[model samples]
Target: MSHADAGPDDDHPHEECGVIGVWNVADAAALTALGLHALQHRGQEATGIVTFDGARFHSHRGLGLVGDNFSDARVIARLPGTRAIGHNRYATTGETILRNVQPLFADFEFGGLAVGHNGNLTNAQALRRALVRRGCLFQSTTDSEVFIHLIAISLYSSITDRLIDALKQVSGAYSLVALSDQALYGVRDPLGVRPLILGRIGGGPGGWVLASETCALEIVGAEFVRDIEPGEIVVINDAGVHSIKPFSRQNSRFCVFEYIYFARPDSVMDGMAVYEARKRIGAELARESRVPADVIVPVPDSGVPAAMGYALESGIEFELGIIRNHYIGRTFIEPTDQIRNLGVKLKHSANRGVLAGKRVVLVDDSIVRGTTSRKIVEMVRAAGAAEVHMRISSPPTTHSCFYGIDTPERDQLLAAHHDLAQMTELIGADSLAFISLDGLYRALGKPGRDPASPAYCDACFTGSYPIALSDHDAAPERQLSLLASAP
Candidate 1:
């Protein structure tokens, strides 16, 4: 569907994209398809794959979950190749539309290039303006397209050199995989604000795989090698892997939310366990915000681990007070204001038998707009909850995210709009509390220092972007011009 047709309620925020690239494989497209399935949680709106068959590039793209998009055997059979790249996108930057579905391919002077990207580009506006001035036409509003044009017009002779030069100019959290006829190239931004990993399968003449998460590797029967180091470019071809360090290495600032909420519990990011980290956050919440309660009820799915931790630490009974509707897909229609108002209730229903006459501690991952949280509180109270105390596992979101996450603009964040006391009243909760920055870090197993710093990118909470953003008010023309002339 076109972006203009999508309504606001249909445009829910999602994390960045998940990318998978495979080289010299007999079943590259199938391998990539499986990898995309494993990384589905990272993105759900659309999926695409571009494959290089010894002679030509074949591609398939559609707007929907990976499974739904590839359900047609004819669609999958059309894409035949030995090398391929796939993308599952969640629309962090641009609108969610078929035109923006990625594994974006371009027929440049050198041949064909397919790129799948994760993370937002901070200088996209400036870069797009620059590119536009040079007569570069853009089909999509996503920042990822800028990189394609940058590589297209570079002065360098080879694709690798042009890609390296193009990357040096753009800034922000990115873990990119680019496919040419002969090789697959993987790059992580200077600060490593996003996660990417490399893996291999089989023995003699084995192929290489690059994915946003290690879980993707496991799905494709590839053994994890290690994470792609920050600022490193890895090229995998028939001659074997080669590496280049174009940008200077800085302190790695992997997004902390990956551990707290975004990633699958079984997935390991930056040498840390996601499930364990979340459980620790729950325990820390109990230690710090000890509100008397009879039962600890998790918000469901993401909130379960933290709730378990809270219940264990507080010696409270853990009850499943909220039950989520598993059948609901991401793109549900809420055509009216009343339906929008009942959005949370449609997805989650309070178990009256469990919550009735009980003082409950409701645990959730984070509160962004606070609308959902408020509605959930009201639902629980309506179900006869005697008192509800809301506990957030992570710190309040105070700033906008320039990375892949689709957090609202600064003023829209509930924490930015109200103080703790005001938010408590607004959500109709007996009390409200968020885990401190230290508690968050401690939960992630990085205690004794700042939880929001040194190791993790907490820019959404601290307003300290690792990369400098271009002027926020830059004109559209100016922004497009910068993109064209990038590098």
Candidate 2:
């Protein structure tokens, strides 16, 4: 079964990708498959693995879950190599198909190169147009493919230099793992809006690994070493792991949404556990929006931990008032709108006995479009809850994300279009409250988001995007030359 439970009404921010790389392992491909499985929450649409044998590079990519694609021994055996890289894709940047399945591979003049990227490149369209003008042929529609074109066109001497050249020209969040015939490179963008970590296996002569989260490292039996510093590159090979800082350092703006929804609960990000951070968020929310309720009811699955934290903090009883159907898959044949609207019941059923005559407080991570939240609220009210108060662990999602997350446009986002009162009415809740921006940072163990040194990227809440939206802001006839510095 898929670790991530989904339904037809899963209208929330979609995750982008999960990347893993291993060097000098006997079961490199197999270990990568396992790592991707552990990080499956970050993506679900497709899976791909690229292996480098002593003689040649082998690749296997397909449109499905990791288990669906890499379950067969034949598939892993087909990719025999001492080193490999893999990707779990969610189609945040490109269409969902076999072609868009990554670690995208290309044969350069130097040798074979495979790239696994975990964030969006903001300036890809401009770069693609420029590359095409310079006679570069494209294989995939993915923005990540532009890196290959840039690297291919560079007059730099070494592979690392060419990669640096390509990276310098682009803008936005990324935690990239790139593997060539001789070396594996792990790089995080200057802003560090995404996550990447390095790990060490038990043995030597290339026991180093790179993954999107610590959970992937644990799954591969690799000990966590450290997070790849923002604007830093670590090149791993038979010799050892070497760190290179090619770009100017900037304040790290790690995505706050990762702790709230994207990352696995078991994973640790930059010295803090994701589950603990979420619980802290819940406690903060309880303090900010205290409501008179007999029981604290979670939205199930992701909201369970937070609900417990809220209950503990607010002195309310935490109960499973809503039961989730974990077996429900993402794809379901819908015959009509009536059946589609029944998606909430298909994935979740309200426990009438627990909710009857009780003032229940519903705790959830965040409401994207308020579609599912509305359905869940209506379902609970129908189940006899006297009053349903909705509490969100994060700030209102007022802006769309351009840094890997698949969020609706500003016009489509419910929070962007409506005020709290309007949103409360739309979601059919007695009251609605989302955590404040400062409260979110407090959950991460900080006093608050310091204006001078804001740590996490709260762009979805504040609309202060650190990276430029090149494509989104470009004029139809604006032929910007991205061959220079950052566009």
- Per TM-score, the best of the predicted structures is 2
| Local accuracy of candidate 2 as per-residue lDDT tens digits, 1-487 | 0136543468678788999999888889999999999988888989999999988999999998899999999999999998999999988676886777899999999998999898999889999999999999988889999999999999997999999999999998999999999999999999888999999985765688899999999888999999999899999988899999988778889999988888888899988898888888999999999999999999878887778889999999999999988777756625678878788888889999999999999999888889989999999999999999999988999888889998876667788779999999999999999999888888788899887778889888877778887887685432232121111
Off by over 4 Å in 2: 1-8, 333-335, 476-487
Clashes of each: 16, 0
Residue 24 alpha-carbon offset, candidate 2, angstroms: 1.2
- Please give, for residues 217-301, the per-residue lDDT of candidate 1 as tens digits: 8888888888899899999999988999988767888888887778777787877777877888899999999998899999877
**What is the model-wide C-alpha lDDT for candidate 1?**
0.83
**Residue 364's C-alpha lDDT in candidate 1?**
89
TM-score of structure candidate 2: 0.95
